[model samples]
Every structure is written in structure tokens, then in C-alpha cells.
Target chain A: MPKGPGEKRQWQFLERMLLIRRFEETVVKMATDGHFRGHYHLYIGQEGTGVPAIAALKRKDFLATTHRNHGHILARGADPGAGLAEILGRATGLNGGRGGTIHLCEPKLGFLSTSGVVGGCISLAVGGGYACAQRRDGSVTMALFGDGALEEGVSYEALNIAALWHLPVIFMCENNSAGAMGMAKGGYPSLVHASKNLLLIPKSMGIKSVRVDGVDAAAVHAATTRAISLCRSGRGPVFIEAMTPRWAGSDPLWPELATGITDLRMATGGAVPTGKHQAWFEHYDPVLRLARELANGGEESVHRLSALDEATRKRIADAADFALASPLPAPETALNHVFVQEASA
Target chain B: MSKQSYAAALVDALHDAMRSDPRVSIIGGYVLGLGPQRTLTDRLKQDFPDRVFDPPTSEAGNAAVGVGASMAGMRPFVDLGTASFSYLAWSQLTNEAAVAHYMTNGRLTAPVTFHMLHGVRGGGAAQHSQSPHAMLWNAPGLEIVAPSTAADAYGLIRTALASPNPTMLVSHAKLLGIETEVSEKKSAIPFGVADIKRRGRDVTVVATSLMVPYCLTAAEALAKDGIEVELVDPRTLVPLDEKTIIESVSRTGRLVVVDECPLRGGIASEIAATVAERGFKHLKAPIVRVTRPDTPVPFSLPLENFVTPDPEKIAAAVRGALKAG
Candidate 1:
């Protein structure tokens, strides 16, 4: 069996990351093809932060994420077919087509909520911490949010409460603003906070704070594992700020495949990328970076990585087909679950 | 039977719930009330030292915490102090808690209870005095309970605590000191049930929350003037007892609605619209509503009194309804 980073387990990480990368690509294609309506966020570039971080969580541990939550759900082992169906607003979706893209969640796998509102998941995860404390189990809650969430006022309140109570919560902030183009430049909005460093916000509240490179999957995994251990031991809450350079595809107002579909051959040196977005394929692409790391072993590793990508692509394509075939919810059932009658049952 | 203040009854209900259910906990320090009610909260904190939490002034955050905790196994009762302050927590209450179950496609439920002391209490002014329960009623999926008497307070709060859906238990600060007989063994009161405070023949006066007691007093005054009135108090606003109100209107052709909320799009407006739509054939005269004028509650005591609906105002509305027929 393979061992260590860029080995067997890292290959599994590569598999999960590939699933997310491919799933995101399919979502963009479906949206562009007019299969769905309304604006939806893409998890294209943040796979490094989500995959490794979520892998550190146990089955019983609770998680709450933000609008860009498709990768988080898939990383937690949610079936891509159900996830894609939910995004397509089909009856077989994870939330029965009611939640759609923004509110997609899997409660059975211990996801508390995938809030559409920014800064909404922080307090919810703190609550999960309180529940875990009450159970006296080793379970912990992880709040995965973007850097923009720090600007909202509730984050301050929630961070303070977690520190005071010493709750078992890991506040994982995926700060993707290092190379992000702001709305002023026709891209998504960047973090707007007075503090020079984001980590100071949590540290000021007496929370144990740390920073890590989000693009480095190994570093992210190590940081997340340490944070979860600190939380499990009742060391209050830990605030992790993972700094990542925003992908070129996310530079525009709406996400576009600027660098085009990943070739996977570029990581094995059979092909090369040469364009304005060449830097993305060279450095920022987490999928290519991990693949290149594994392929560095030998030519055998190259064929193995390519084969793994082929299988992941096939699985995602099948999931998309399943979602496309799923039926829309019946019209007469619109008013169901409005209120829980006889809730005790 | 035991005589207890309305506030005391609410405290007792919470105390009993926490004692019986270990998963039930209270947030936001002391529950807002007078003298003995505050003492009861103190005792509650002492008994459940680990459960009660006194977080800093963070309505939005703590409200969301209650929502999150409720979904994750614990039932939390978040005290939001004054009704006006609920504005800070409006998003958490309306967006997150109210829509969780439906949005999640029945995969999750937020069994959280929010307590707020509502309505005008003397010189509470614009910031302190408010009855936003009507606004919350506009948001679907929330169970709104506003009790008018001590016994109703005891029974209704228990039901709210036991409910699996998010519940808003609105208590009027003005009604706290009022005392009435409450059975020690009284069970939980079901929602959507209206209690007829007084039965009469001429006019049906539908009131809610603080307006119920004023309407009852007006019913007695109207009786002396040979204008018999049937007073209906809707215990819960969301699942309103429309059947009882419609049946009462059937008995008495004249209808009068009274409420402490403002006249524009208030509780009175909703009840009047319901009657006009569903029970239109039974009406002999145009319905009259005694409600607070569409203005911010003034700081001056006399201005506050001038704007708010009182017993005399309700009595005049009932007599006018009878005369207009």
C-alpha cells in the first residue's frame, strides 16, 4: 500500500479533491447550459482548504458552512447525485429540492446548516459546541466560512461567547483574498475589515488563533488536525486563518472557467499550459499541485494519477446524469413541512 | 387552586420545564419581570448553574445560538429582554429559525423558544415599548403565543416549551402584576383555541394580548349601558381560532376589534379583514377597531395615554358598532 503524504492516503485526498473539482466544473457547465436559474457560487479554487479540513472531522462531528458549500458537503462524503439534484431543484436532492444551491445540507451526516447569510454559521457552530459539551462526548463542531464573513457583526459576538465558555469549536476561516480581485475590478467582493491582520480579531477575544497556507493541502490538514485536537481537549475555540490566492476563474463577477478544464497531463509533464492564466495551472491549482507532487515519484505514479482522474470524471458525469434525470417536485406538495404538526412525534 | 401573578406563572412554567427536561436551558441572564419574578430567575440560575448562560449584550448572536443549539439536541429559551430589541435579532428569528424546517425539507427542526416582554408599559417611550408580535406574525412558520391572564400564561408557556417548532412567547410587562386563580394540576393549553372571557348577545369584541383585559372591562361597562358584548381572547396569534371568532360573530351581528399595536397593518386590521372575508354575511354593521394611532409611542405619559387604546375607547367602539347597525 502507498504511505505518507503524496502516497496512498494522499491519493485518497487527491480522489476527494478531484471529486469536488469535477463536481464544481459540472455545476458551471449545467448553469451555463441553462439547466438551472438564479445566481450560484462555485467552489472551484477552495478545494485545498475544504477537502483536507473536512477530512479531519469524524462522522459524529458537526459542521456548518456558508453559501459556497458544495465542496464542503461533497468532502463530508455526501452523495454527489443527491447534492447535484438539490442544486437542480429535483425531488431526489439532498434537501428534497427545497434548499436549492445556497441552503444545501446533509443533516444525517451531522451538518447543522449551510447558511446563505454571511456570518450565520459561526453562532450555529458555537451552539453545536454547547451540545457536544452537554453530551460529554469527544465530538466537536467546525465552522467553515470565507474571509468576507469576518466583516459581519455577529462574528464578534459568537467568537466572544465561544472564548468565554471554552466551547469545543474550530473556527476555520478560509481567507481567499490574497490575490482576489474586488468588485471594483469586476470580481467578487473582498474582505473589508479595519484590522490589519484577521487573526487579531479572534486573538483579541482570547481565542487561540493560528494561520496556515490554504493552497498547501498537507499544511492545511496538519493545522486542522491540531485545531480539532485542541478543541476536543476542551481548550476553548481555535481560530484558523488559511490564506489562499484566489483562482483566476473566480476573478470575474460570475465564475468562468478562465483556465479551461484541467488537463491533468500538465501535472505529469506530457503537456504544458501557456496563456494569461498559465500561473493558475502552474501554482494555484490544488488538483494539479497534488497530482504533480505524487507524479514526482515516477512514471508509474503518472499513469496511476491519470487513471484516478479518469475514474473521478466518470463518477461525476454519472452523478450529473442522475441529477438531470431526477424529477421536479410535485406542485401539490408545495405546502408540505411548513409547520411540524404533532412535533413530538 | 392557587393565586399567582402572571409573571410568576411564567417563571413557574420555565422552572418546571427545566426541572423535568435536562436538555432545556435558558440564555440571556435573568428573564425580564418584576420583584418575585426576578427572584424566580435567580433561583433558576442557582438550581441549574451549568445550564443558564449570561452572555454579553448580543441579541443576534445569542438568538442564532439558541437556534443552532435547538437543532443540535438542546432546547434553549433565549430571553430577548424588550420587544423593541427583538429588531436586532429579527434576522436570526425570521430567516434562520422560522424557515429552517421548510428550507431543509423536514430534515431539521429548531425547537427553540424566544421570550420577549412586549407592549406599552407606562413611560417606556419609543425604544422600550413595542408590540412587534404582529410583525412577527407576518413571518410564517413561527408559533406566536401571547397570554392575557396568569392561568393562560402558565398553560401556554408549557406548550411553547414542549413544541418542536420555533415559538415566540410574548408577555406584556403591564400584565405582569395581575393575579388570578390557576389550578396546580392545569395541563398545557393547545394553540388556535380562543377563550371567551365574557359571553353576551349584542356585539363580539375580538382582542389579543394586553387588549383582552381592557376589552373584558369594557364588556362589563357596556353591560350597564344595555349594550351586551361577547369578548374573545385569541391565546395564540399564528393558529388563530378563526372558527370561534366567526361563530361569535354569527351570534352577535356587530363586531369590534381592539389591539395595542398601531392601526396601520396591525393585529386589529388582520382580524377585521378575516371577518370581512370569511364572515361577511353575518355582519350587520361595519366593524370598528380600537387601536393605537399610527405614530411612535411618545415619551410623555399623557401623549402615550392619548395614543393607546383603553377600556373607554373599546366601550365606545362597541357602542358605535351597535348604533351604526
Candidate 2:
């Protein structure tokens, strides 16, 4: 099954990517089936950025994410059952049912916060950087946000502070709009901003900034590795803008599986790309692209990938069942965590 | 016991907290704003240079830094300068810091103490003169401490620093010079405990922050006119000592809530509502509120005074409540 020297790393990346993909798909299915309420953003096409970027972080490094945070959390190795339970407001959820979809975070896993406020995580991560600086333990903080977050006033303030303080933070902006949005039809665009280039926003503060292809996992991993090393050396607060085309499902105000469920076989010879989503399958889909890369090792590699996909599907299915079976938080326990209680004698 | 100025007690509290815990750190420029208090903070900075930070004047961003630092095991003391300027940080303080513990369902804690100088101070105009504690009280999961004495300031600031929840330490510029006997042996006072500044039986005067001093003067004046006033200073707003206030009202059968906020939807309104809701039978007369008028504090001295509550206003409110029923 292992053809190349780095085949293990390749399979690991593919497995994490598949986990995020199927977890988000299950989220959509559960939402459609009336298991949860409220609007939720999907991290479908941007898996390449989150998986690779997070993989580069050390165990001590802190991370803060935005509304499109499900992929980032899963990439950090959070339990899917707990994540889905949190979305369902169950007592066994990650946050004990308090922080649902948008705020699904695990502080134990070095997550500072998952802010529902557009650019809120950016500023919070700066504080995390300050904490790392105080500890002087070689830890860094990463702020994972979308292009729309750059339009917020707090972003400028946070970026300027990070630069002045030389705080160890990596500002990763995932630009899924890909410059094709705001056209005559077919797509929704990022919020309008005067800056022609989002990178300039951080560059203006004298911050070291770079741009990368969001669909290329290797490129993102390289950029994040370099950024983390720089931050750990105290020459930090780097900015990376990863560009990806908006997923067709993310076009409407609410997320819809416009491409249907991703067909991994389309990467192998068994299936063929067709219809309006042909361009997405060919280039933009990070999961399929990685699958196709692994399948390039011939028939044995394809069989291994197929088995991996089936196991991943089963795991997500079990997570969905666990979330569905988990009980909702007790009505009287709403006031439990409002204030931190002192331990009893 | 030694005489300590309100400002000195506050500075000492911060020093004690930093010395007691390695994780306690201070953030902001000129903690108490530009004044003699700056000298005290300058000393603090010299003592703990590594623990103190003077960030740019991004109120919301700085407050968020405190929230973020707290989440990372640092107990941050963030100063928002003036209560008016705190409006800029309302979102960070209310949305992020205050909600961190509750939203995370005990998985996280933001033990941040936000300090601000609130209330009217002479000719400080509309933007400079504001008491936003009432508005802040509306947001759940935040501990609001408004100490009325040098001793209370020394005691409450320590408790605020030690709290596991986000806390707001509301101070007053006008009360800085006021001196009271503060014992060095006193420990951190627990929250949700009310202090009776003066004992009387005719009316219960509930005051906060600078209003406590004004109400003290009013109580003295009323005592001379054959009326006794019992004064209750609720140290913390979020975990309010309703029992103390209600018991005082039960004895006096009259309540006069004096606060520096606007009359409409102010701290006085909330206290009055609480009394009416739970202590209705104890109140023999309708409750009266002595507060700043619902208007932008004018720049002119007389116009500002006309809207601000003072000793005369508190005394008048007590007399009015006494005669109401």
C-alpha cells in the first residue's frame, strides 16, 4: 500500500481531509433532517488550508478560528462525536452544549476561542501571542480567519499591535472568494473593502506577509511551517493569505451541497467529471485533488484509499448516531456555568 | 489603622495582587488616566516591568487582549481609562470576556479585571462624564464592583483580581482624594456583601461609588432635621446583596436609590425594581431614585450640576419618600 517514502504522511493528510469533508457533510445532513437549528457555515473547499496549516502547529501552539471553524477544529484532532454533540446542544458536547456550531472549540487542545464575531478571533489570538511571549516557552498563536475578517476595524488594531509587540502569531487569511466573486451572477463576494489586496492590510503595518494557493496542501504546509519557525524565534506576527474559489454550495446565503456529496471515485478511473461542477472537481476540490495524488501510485494505492474512505464514512456515521443519542442539557442547568463556583470543602 | 486616600488604596490593591500572584499582570497606558495616579502606576511599572504592558489606545482591542491573556492562564488587569471610553470596549468586554465562561460551559475562564473611572467630575463634558455601570449591569456573567471607601477600594480590588469570572472595577475621579481609615490587616472582602456606612431608622439610602459620599452628607443633614437615614453601599452589582438592602428597607420602610447614571434605565431603576419585586411589603412608601437627569452632561458647570445628583438631591429624595405615604 505504501509506494513512496512519504506515503505515510500523504495518507495521514488524506485521512484528515476526508474526516473534515465527511464531518461537514454529516452536519449538513443533520441540519436538513431537523436535528439542529440556526445557520452554519461549511468548510468544504478550504480543507487544504486548515488541515495543512494546523498540521504544522506544535502541541503547545495556540489557535483561534472564525465562523467557518468546523474544519479547523477537526484538523486539530477534536472528537467528531463531541463536535456534533455541541452542534446539537447535547450535554456531552465539547462545551457542554453552551458553544454550538460557530463556537465549537476545545481549549484543552490549545484552542483559545472560536469567535462568531467576524474579526474577533484575530484580536483574541494577539492576546494569546502575548501570553506565549510572557511564558517565553517557544509557543506561538495562529489566527485562522476568512478574507471578510480583514474588513473589520479590530483586524487593523490587532495587526498593528502584533507588529509593535513582536508577538508570536500567524495571521492566516483563507480567501475563498478567489477574485471570481462579485460577477454578473453565480457567486457571492467577500465584503467590499478599499484595499485592493488583502495582504497590504498586514504589510502596511510592516508585517511579513505571503500569499499561497489554498488548494495546494503542500504549499500551505510549507508556508505555515516557515511562519511558525519565525514566530518561535520571536521575529513573528506573519500573515498568509491562501486563495480558494468559493464552493458552489457556499454561494447561497445558507450552505447547500450543490456539488452533491464529493465522489472520490471521480479521482480514480472509475468515475468521470461532468456538468457545471466540472471545473471544481478538476482543480478546486482539495479532497479529490489529494485523493488523485495518492491514487497516482496505481491499483494497490487506489484500493488502500477506497478502504480508508469506507472506514472514514463509518466513523462519521457512528459520530452522527452518538450525537443523536446524546441527551440535551438539562433545562435547570442553564445557570451552572454563569459564574465559576468555588470548590466545596 | 491609618488614613489612606481612595486612590492610594486602589494602587496598593493592584500592587498587592501582582505580588501575591505571578500570573497577575497590568495592561493599558496610565492606568487611572493622566493625573497623580499616573505616578503610582509608573512605580508599579518600574517594580514589575515584565508584567506590565502599555498598549496603543485601542480600547476594544486592549480589552480583548486582557480576555485572551486570561484564557491563557494570565490574570490581566485592563484599564479602559474613562467610563465613556469603555463604550468603545463594550463589545469586547460584554460579548467576549463576559461570555467566555458561560459560552464555553466551564471549559474556559476569562479572569480579567477591567478598571474604569466612572461618574461626573466637574467640567468634564458629555463624552468625558458618564456612568455606564447601569448599562454594564444588564449584561449577565460580569461582576461589577463599585467601592465607596478607601477600605472598600483596597478590599474589593483584591477580590476582583482573585475572581474567576470577568470583573469590572468601577471607580470615580471625584472620590480619589477622599481619605478614610484603612487597616493593613484587613483581607480581601468577599463580593455580594453590603456595608452599612451609616445607621439610622427613618429611611434607607442605597448609594454606589461617588454617590455614597454624597448620600453620607445627605444623611447627616437629614439627621439634623429630626430624620434618621440608614445608608447601604452595595459593593458589587452583579451579585447584589439584596438581603441587606431589603432588610434595611424593612426597618426604615423607605428606599432612596442614588446613582450617578441617568434616571431612565439606570442602576437606581434596577435596585428599585428589585426592591419592588422581592421586598414589596417591606416598603411602606413608594421608592424614590436620585439620579442624573436623562440628558447629555452639558459642558457648562451649572448645566452639569442641574443634571447631576448631589447631597441636596439625596436629602430631598429621602424627605420626599418619607412624606409619600
Looking at model 2, the pairs that clash are: none
Candidate No. with top lDDT: 2
Could you give candidate 2's per-residue lDDT for residues A1-345 as a string of tens digits?
356646777688889999999999999999999999998999999999999999999899899998889999999999999999999999999988988999999999899867899879999999899889988999999999988888788878889889999999999999887644453464555657787798888888999999999999889999999999999999998999999888888887677898998889988878999999999998999999989998988998899889999999999999999999999998998877778863200
Q: Clashing residue pairs, candidate 1?
A: none
Candidates in order, interface RMSD in Å: 2.3, 2.6
- Tens-digit lDDT track of model 1 for B1-325: 8888887788788888989898888897757644346765777888889889997788888898888888887889999988898999898899989888888888898889999898888899999889998899898889999999888998898888888899999988888888878887856898888999889999999987788888888888888878888999988987889999999999998789999988889998999999999999999999998888999999898899999989998888888898896
**Predictions in order: chain A TM-score:** 0.96, 0.95
* Model 2, residue B211: C-alpha shift (Å): 0.6
Per-residue accuracy of model 2 over B165-252 as CA lDDT, tens digit each: 8899999988888898888675799999999999998999999899998999988899999999999999889789999999999999
* Count of backbone clashes, every candidate in sequence: 0, 0
Question: Which portions of model 2 miss their true places by more than 4 Å?
Answer: A1-5, A179-189, A342-345
Sliding window of 10 residues with minimal summed lDDT for model 2 chain A:
A179-188
DockQ of 1: 0.57
Candidate 1, B55: how far from true, in Å? 1.6
